[model samples]
Target: MTIYVLIAVMTLALVLLGSSVRVITQFERGVVFRFGRVRPGTRGPGLALIAPVADRLQKVNMQIITQPVPAQDGITRDNVTVRVDAVLYYRVVDPVRVAVDVQDYGSAVLQVAQASLRSIIGKSELDDLLSNRERLNQGLELMIDNPAVGWGVHIDRVEIKDVALPESMKRSMSRQAEAERERRSRVITADGELQASRKLAEAAEVMAEHPAALQLRLLQTVVEVAAEKNSTLVLPFPVELLRFLERATPPETTTAASTAATAPSESAPPTAPARTNGAVPAGRAVYPAAPDAAAVAHAVAER
Candidate 1:
């Protein structure tokens, strides 16, 4: 009877020992409380012993956690109402503080993040929040991280997900952007005009220094106009024509032989060149004081 009683007592003690010992996972740490007081530190991932009925173990994951915050509608500094949402990355650094200092660390971090977002939005303009999101996220993380230290949570990062704007504001922004583009285009065109006028003034000063350059420029202009296949090309001349006055008495002044000797011989009268007609008229012919007979003959042959 004594051996049987001793065997029963030993079996009961072994069962209690097995039940009090816990094996922590690789990614987890055990926070042990002995008689309502937390242990010195976290227990290892392999094996941990706790006093039966007096010690309790709470498992705390050491891995990083991602928590998404819902959209928050708040008024900006510019008095514009907008919806804003963000995500937060947090991790538990100290399990003892998390168990003793806070009731729920995860909920505490989330609530702190939500309040930080609103505080940031209240100080920023709608445009700044919409355009400069990275700045806002950093500010949110800094603000939340400071408050979350007491709760044993470390804020890794904060991310602004979306910002919803009113339709009327969107239309206004588009119109403003279009107007800015138009203003820039007008400024560019005005600059070009100013540059062109300055160049023309400089050219005139240069031409005044050399009168012959003016004549050459006029010829260049004529050539350029002709290149466009214009209906007419203008040719300007400013030379005088001096010819001898004719009298009817010239027939009686000399004998036939003398007249023949004085008069020049003419084999034939040269014909004028016929201009080649194209789709557009090349130009009208303006006569000089005297046309070179050889030139006329050559032109006729070439034409």
Candidate 2:
């Protein structure tokens, strides 16, 4: 009986020791509480021992925790209603505080994250939520981290995952975007027209200074049109050709006009004797007096 009692006692002690010893992973920390009060600091990666029945050990993971915040509905500063969801990355920094300061750190962090998200949404506009996520994320991290710091939680990062707007708002945005694109297209087209007009004005100045360029341009246009193998081509008469013709004839015309104005007129003929219709007066026929041959010859020689 004495031998059996000794063996039982030894077995009970071994079992209690085994129960008190804990193997903590590298990514975890143990928070020890003695007599309902949290002990200082934290227990580490390998083995942790606690007093049986008089102490408690709570294992807190030190690894980064990825918690997805559910979609939250809120009105923005611009009075736009939207739903926003996010992802939170955090970890327990101080296990003693995490275990002692907060009843449930995970739940508290989640609540803080949700509240921070809603507050940020209320402070920002819809445009910022959609286009300025980086800023919003930083703000959210700060907001949540400030409250969570007291509970020994460190916010690694916060990211907005999705934002949903109303159907009408989406349609309105689509129309606005379309209008903006149309305005840009019209501006570009007008700019092109303005540039083309300036170039054409420059070309006109160049062509006016050099008339031969007009002829060459005309010929080039004809060639280009002909290359299309069209059956009918309407060729326009160049005004330059008319100008050339007028310049070529002016000198000769001026000389002829001057000569005609200086020449003397021929003398009038003497009237023949009155005669009956179809009857000839039988006598020597009187003739008209002609201009002097010497005067006519002098005028011709001067011309």
Candidate 3:
């Protein structure tokens, strides 16, 4: 009977020892509640001992937690509808407060993040939401951190994951971008044309000062066109050469036979003789003045 009682006592002690021991991982912290009240300080990693009947040990994770907030739909300040979602990075800074001050710090942080995101969306314009996300992220972190600080949770960072705009808005943005590109193209083309016109005007001045340059340019153009090996080649005749010919050649006298050939037909009425020295001469006939040889040759060449 003595041996049985000793065996029973040993079993009970082993069970109590096992129940009182708690293992805390390196990434976790142990919080104790004694008699329904939290302990003053937290226990660091490793083993912890507590009374089985009078104390409770709760392990709190100390590592950073990544939480993804769901998408929130809201209207922006510019009266544009949008949907935005984000990710949150945070961790517990004070385990004692985290365990006592908040019932569930993770859930609390998530709720605050969602609310803050919606508030930011409502206060920002569509342009800012799409382009100025860094500023919006900082503002969002401050908003979430304000309430999280009280719960002993520190918000490390907040990031805007994605912003969803309507299809119509997307098309409008595409059109705006296209129009901007077209405007730049037109401006550039106009600038190029203006530069070309200025350069051409300068070249014309140079060519006018040196007439030989014009002849040389014409010959160069002909050479380039001839290199193409085409069947036909057209050459330009310079106006200066024609004017030089006309100036060098003298007028020709009209022959009586040619004048008879050019004279009016007999059916035409005859006019009075032309006056000489400001007086009409008797027994003298008036014939039309002969045409200029250069003019007649030019007219014949044109026909």
Candidate 4:
């Protein structure tokens, strides 16, 4: 009877010892709760011993945990509706607070991250969400870390994963971008044309001062056109060249040209005078006798 009692007592002690012993991994921390109340400090990695009946050991992972936040729908400050999602990286910094402060740190962090994401989306514009994610991410991290710090969770990083825009908003943005690009192209082309016109005006003034330059340009144009091997070649006659030739003519040649222009052609033709009622009208003949032309003729015949 004494031997059987000793064996029963030894078996009970072995079971208690096994239950009290715990193996903690290097990436985990052991938290102990005694009488339903948390202990002062946490246990580090490795073997831990606790009172089997009064003590409970909870292991909190110290390694970084990646939690994906679900997509949240919200309206932006600009009155644009959008859907946004994110990812959070976190880890337990204080095992005591993690075990005592929050019921489930992982779920708590995930909820906090989602709320923060929605709040950020509401406060920011659509442009900021799409183009300024770095600032938004920093803001999100700060927001999550503020509440998480009390729970013994450290926010390693927070990042916005994707933003879904409405189809109408997307089309509007595309048209706006296209219009801006077209406006820029038109402005650039106008500027180029203005510059080219100014350059052409300056070139024209220079060509006017130098007659030989104009000739050279004409000759160059001719050469270029001739190089195309076209059957028809047209040469431009400049009015300036004609003016230059006119100015260079001799004075005698100019006077003779004026005289020749005034002179009549020698085509032969004789004009005859007409007699009315078988008598010439007075003052009508080319050479008329004095006032009494008939009396003077009759006196000469009587003499």
Q: Choose the strongest candidate by lDDT.
A: 3
lDDT for model 4, on a 0 to 1 scale? 0.88
Expressed as tens digits, the lDDT of each residue in 120-140 for candidate 3 is 999999999999999999999
For model 1, residues 47-155, the per-residue Cα lDDT tens digits are 8888889999999988999999989988999998888999999898988888899998888888888898888989999888878988888889999999888888899
lDDT by residue (131-185, candidate 2, tens digit) is 9999999999999999899999999999999999999999999999999999999
After aligning candidate 1 to the native by TM-score, how far in Å is the CA of 87 from where it should be? Answer: 1.7
lDDT of each: 0.83, 0.88, 0.89, 0.88
lDDT of 3: 0.89
Full candidate order by TM-score, most accurate first:
3, 2, 4, 1
Q: Output the TM-score of candidate 3.
A: 0.78
Error of 4 at 38 (Å): 2.0
Flag regions of model 2 displaced more than 4 Å. 230-244, 248-303
Clashing pairs in 3: none
Q: Which residue pairs in candidate 1 collide?
A: none
Q: Write down the worst ten-residue block by lDDT for model 3.
A: 231-240
Each model's number of backbone clashes? 0, 0, 0, 0
* Shift in Å, residue 300, candidate 1: 23
Per-model TM values vs. the true structure: 0.67, 0.78, 0.78, 0.75
